[model samples]
Target chain A: MSTDSNPITTEAEEKKEEVYEAEHVHKVYDIIAPHFSATRYKPWPIVERFLREMPAGSVGLDVGCGNGKYLGVNPSLFMIGTDRSRGLASIANHEFKHEAHVADALDLPHPPGRFDFAISIAVIHHFSSPERRVQAVRSILATLRTDKENPGRALIYVWALEQKNSRRGWDENSPQDVFVPWVLQKGNKSKQPKEKSQKQAKNLVETEVKATASPSGDSAQTRAACEPEEEKKEAEPNPVYNRYYHLYKQGELGADAVEAGGKVIEAGYEKDNHWAIIIPA
Target chain B: MKLLTANFITCSVKSCQSVTPALSFRDAELAREEIDFSPLFLRNILPRIDWPLLQRTAKELGFPALPETKPELSPIAEGDEEGVGSEEEQKLLKELHSLLLETSVQSGKLVCANCGHEYPISQGIANFLLPNHLV
Candidate 1:
């Protein structure tokens, strides 16, 4: 909303992003900026699921808000995308960051319980130790709790550490850098999807779970993100037209990830293609 | 809540992130009434905003499918499928303000850009003003 004239100008937006500049803001997102695209980088299904779930007009934080790329979101949420990337701050502004800025997810600068829900996508592994990753999640909730009006429990989604050859972005520099998390809803008896990609045809299925995100109740959802390498390897070379997506397996993250952060509501996918988490503001 | 609450801050944080406040899910909806940007304004704005981020936010905030690139000054002249010099394009843009830029979510926090500060919005306004020491 600032008077920004240069589409590529960082100066104008920089004038607005002076606050919350900390280390690690850019490290987690540096590679993701140019190479990332809402349509190209991540699977559309994950975005679809997020939009179906997260509550609208809630005070929420996108932990790893690399380049501020939200997959697909409901048209009703009040959003402030953050990343450690200070460079991305202006980008967030040029894109209408009502108050987007560069901040450290690991060491947040927020009061306890100030935010409604804290969301970190594909950002956990960036930390050297699992303890740090968990701490960062706690910091976010702490900020969420700072608010006097904060309801109670926080809804956190940690991309359990599932790394496959495909989702690696074809960069082998550091396999441990990125971890993806996805899982079924709580207490759902549905058997976990097989590690091997199954082409078994099934009825077009879509399910919606509407659960309010408060200070209490189901909080965290951990599932290894779907890695795209295996599927891409299985695909014939140079085969264009079909979509390529990462399907996370296991080892992405775990119960400890939540405990490391604090008390949280764990949410995972329950049914096949039917996982939705509603985060209250 | 007042309109300037988010922008009007009393903190010393010099960083933009600190000075600004978090945008609550409520602001995205409430900002609709408080903000009144015109397509003409957004025409000037689109180029300034992060295209991908804005596109996603716009869609989330109720704006319809936006073009891939920043809207050109002569957006209609660019021969958008809406047609160059088309009245429809102009009309649609005017509507965009109400949907994306106009909405103000008061009673939340804005992440500051100057000092990475967190400016709270007690009312509708975002307190962005900074204090002396941190500034």
Candidate 2:
């Protein structure tokens, strides 16, 4: 609910942000990983192209590879994926033989300067603080090969705040840090209310509905409009989890990549996400 | 985790960056799953494979000892890009594919050489999320 604009000054503050993200980001994904994975089966074109273009036998890292969707893509390359949420990592491994692990983006397990490439898609934005975001990027970039003749590359994607044409309609004026609600249908196998009591769950959903209906009410209305009529008529309110995201503005991802000791080679807006390809400087 | 994946990963702990021999397996339970063999893929990835590390890992897992030196394969000729190469080369690539791609660590722990941190592996997935103090 709160936005952090000031620079984190102390380790204590940095730890505090980690805790915040653990609550708002990591825990949310753990609870919704299966549902999230179901919706994330498709690989974005740019990401697929990046993987497909890699030379056969090249090894790489998928830093926040949720569901390991991209792991099997271009099987010629050996890609290891890591996710902060164990649930998501488990799904990624179970669904396919691709290697996945539970590891934080800021503290990856891969050896430094070893990978041929790395890709972190829709991952770094979960960091609650700017410093942590840049640190995550730095950690990813550290895993790439820094050879002068064949420098390693990394492709990173983050939700963009400038998606005026998208259904959510966020734009330049929207707050960069916001909580996005993910409505989990009750019948889904993974659906479980965070609150034990039905009354508490109802209260939680009401609060989230009010929050969505307050300023930028279009998202809530649009979601309702798109949902099937049967979903609206359900007796029990579906559990809604709010995930925190720091939507990147134009040029921000490239700037952060550079600040993280990388040179941005390609940067653009794609499908409401800001993506950049960077190599170690 | 694939046996090959172990070659690229080490201790997640920042202080253990200089650790020697990377990570060593402990109580490893391995499984072999069939994967499509591609000679070209093996040939291309051979250079990146840390032969010594791979040898150590293979020995620990009770696999047959690898050759002392890493295998070197000649590049595929232009007209035979899809060919599986000579019989000897084909045999080497298939063995490499079976060892590196098909052989996987089903359950175990990867202990760091320097920090002695134990990263547990279950159902072929490793958990490298360290405790707060280590981070």
State interface RMSD in Å for all models: 11.2, 0.9
The 10-residue segment of model 2 chain B with minimum total lDDT is B14-23
| TM-score for the B chain of model 1 | 0.46
Q: Residues A184-215, candidate 1, lDDT per residue (tens digit)?
A: 12221223333331111011010111122111
List residue ranges in candidate 1 displaced over 4 A.
A1-28, A37-48, A96-99, A145-252, A261-264, A269-281, B1-135
> lDDT (CA) for every model shown?
0.40, 0.82
Q: Look at candidate 1 and tell me the lDDT of residue A60.
A: 53
Q: Candidate 1 on B1-135: residue-level lDDT in tens?
A: 222222222222323233333232223434444454344434543442435544545554455777788555554454353332457656656655554555555455644344445655443433333442343
For model 2, the superposed segments whose C-alpha errors exceed 4 Å read A1-9, A189-231
Per-model TM-score on C-alpha atoms: 0.41, 0.87
- For model 1, the local distance difference test gives 0.40
